[model samples]
Target: MSELIARYFDRLAGREDAVLTDLSGGLRRSVTGRDLPDLTDRVAGWLAAQGVQRGDRVVAVFDNRLEAALLLLAALRHGITLCLQPANAEAQALADLAAGLGARAIISAATPCPEGATPLTLEAAAASPAHPAPDLAPQTPFTLTFTSGSTGAPKGILHAAESFLGCAAAFNRQTGIGAGDRFLNVMPMYYMAGIFNGLLAPLAAGASVVIDAAFGTPTALRFWPRVAEEGITALWLSPTMLSLVMRLDRGDKVLPAGFRRLFVGTGAMAARDAQAFLDSYGMAPLQSYGLSELLYISVDDPGQPHFGSVGRPLDGVRVHLDADGRLGFSTPHAFLGYLVEGALIPPEPVFATSDLGALEDGILSILGRSDDIILRGGVNVNPIEIERALAPLFKGRGFCVTGLPDATLGQKVVLVFEGATARPEDDEIWARARQIVAQGPGRAQLDARAQIAALPLGPTGKIRRAALRETLAAAEGAA
Candidate 1:
């Protein structure tokens, strides 16, 4: 792990002109490659002074900034395991996570540390002298990332530097993203996608990255302008973000000249939206699939994109469907294991993902999760099929179909939508949705409809289906 950090720094040592731009507050703070190591070393020295040692766990809550990046590299160099929590995470939740991991210290930028952990501010850490890097084994665990917990309690997944770095290098090679390309990163650092694909992968490819705090509706509206300003060549966004961007009125506007490709993942994008994005921007958004357990499973080729398919498996990854049609994969970048009570539990050789999917001619197309299947009178109804069919009707809006407990049918399919402020009549919207489903294949499965002011979304912009289901149940009970 330390050796990898050493090598990365060694490569940047002579490239003093290379820069990493931090765009947290709309103001750019450009740090040269030469200055980065010095910042990292200072943080490492502060960590060492605070009694941090190799194998010790450190919790950090920071936005995308030069200090955050420095902390990550410093932690890797000093052989300290890092657990990155969301910057806006609840105080009690942060405390619980720190206690569970037995964290040696807590680092925060402007945020207060939880009780029971030593507080190390980013400002203070950066003022310390340089500390010598540590020696560590390649297999040593360096990062501990938590799952989104959309379905249940979040699990802490432990990872060694070699595993993730190898995956990043392979991804860069397979995707043809390298040196001259500029990537704009807006994903949160807490997630594996944000850390591996957003930061490390681009750095490994010798590509410059523009780090933004996070992507939201405002970011979507301003995306093209930023691309034009930064000369960005590549980007990785979620389907929700793409939909939001497409909703904007770009009258007489054109896509930036240097823009190369856009990668979409983390959730299924409707085929209609994918096509519209391609038609409007003159470049199709390449779809891909991956999970925290294993990084960079598959990515569609930009030159020959299949709208709904997440492309073929990358080299060193073996993917196949299980007997139940669940997507299963084994990759060189698979995590060490789930961290349970400070102990590492070995994961299975092949991970059976919660998602149901099909691999036809090496192209992977994701169906909804098995748990998301609506069993209406013993007939399995795929929500994705219904959602895709209704996508066009609710063009700029958000909607999802799920099953609710019913007296007669066992489970009844219900459509939930994100209602606009001045939404059309509920009856009218429901009737239109039902009409679409009736014309589609899952008409018989439809049972009820409801609307919420806004859909519950996770940090990564994925709809929180489990939470949405709970909300639906409460609404149903009220009536």
Candidate 2:
């Protein structure tokens, strides 16, 4: 077992009855530390009985449910290779992914397995008779997850016990999230934002997590109230979810009372949204920055939050910025590499991300993605500059700006609104947007406008700008 998991079991040595997790929403169960040794043993032995020996991969399709968490811990304990995919995804697509993994078995009742592949539902796997478990050493290849596939097809990210646990430990030590704190996690378990930040970090801290499988707009509406009722001390949310909750909050003030932490990540939080959260709760949401490959690079100190910043670097993380503001980082805990077609593809020597950001007084602020910067009329126009200027015109509803191919200017700036309602007054709204930009300091110009019922967003709430850009370019070409 990894040292981290061993230490976790050590922490529960005398406190076996202590609750480790409270699961609700889709599945309801509360597991105490006492359940660990026996539960994990059962899971491992069952797989062993099914001929899933060490180094053999198993694909587990799950949400933020208890089964997934137990299975991960069990897999890690026995050193079985496990690939986690979200259960909420399309069944056939997930089946295809599972098949591509060449996994020994597919673990899901909801998803159908590809022909000639073995299927092991969670219920059956847990109930199987115990057998001898094969134990692989700590640094061996373990969990496999995929990238968001926003820019292209999802790439499988391979990680070992050392890389995963080391990063989890750093988050716990830096963020000081542990023991007495109970987390409310609405994020999907399959994503890094949800699994690493929301699950593993808290677990490493000896803190209990409340997994909400039914989290959505309705849940977000009652978010604060629910937190208050459950005695939940900390919570995790994406900026997109924050924006939605802010819109639906009804301005009915509710004191946080005892809720000490509100962690935001997965995307850059707009300044207005950050301010709005503080204005409502009297506590600023602690912003952190990292990627699936890097685990976590930086996290805000809960004691001192500098609004509009993702905050300082975590321990052992080195960050640098290019002259043009593109961000790069070197971390001790990067994932092994991408696993493709039975071959391991190592990571690039230099870890420069496509994100554009800045560091001021050692605090990092993500300006936007490199693609978010628009080039029009031989001038670099920031879409954020245009969006901020027009916030009032849209009354802060929801929107974004980007540059598209133009016959005259090389790139024509365009506006994308979230809703597709075609109002008769759209022409006036477009004219007003133009006037707003005309008066802004950047000399940015608005050329056209369109509305989409929903923006193309990654699971973690980050807008898929590259995908959006493609769609817009296609539309422009058709026009």
| Backbone clashes, candidate 2 | 0
Q: For candidate 2, what is the lDDT?
A: 0.75
* Model 1 lDDT per residue over 22-88, tens place: 8887577776677777777888888888878778988877666766677777776677889987777
RMSD of each: 2.3, 2.8
Candidate 1 accuracy as TM-score: 0.93
> Residue 189, candidate 1: how far off, in angstroms?
2.4
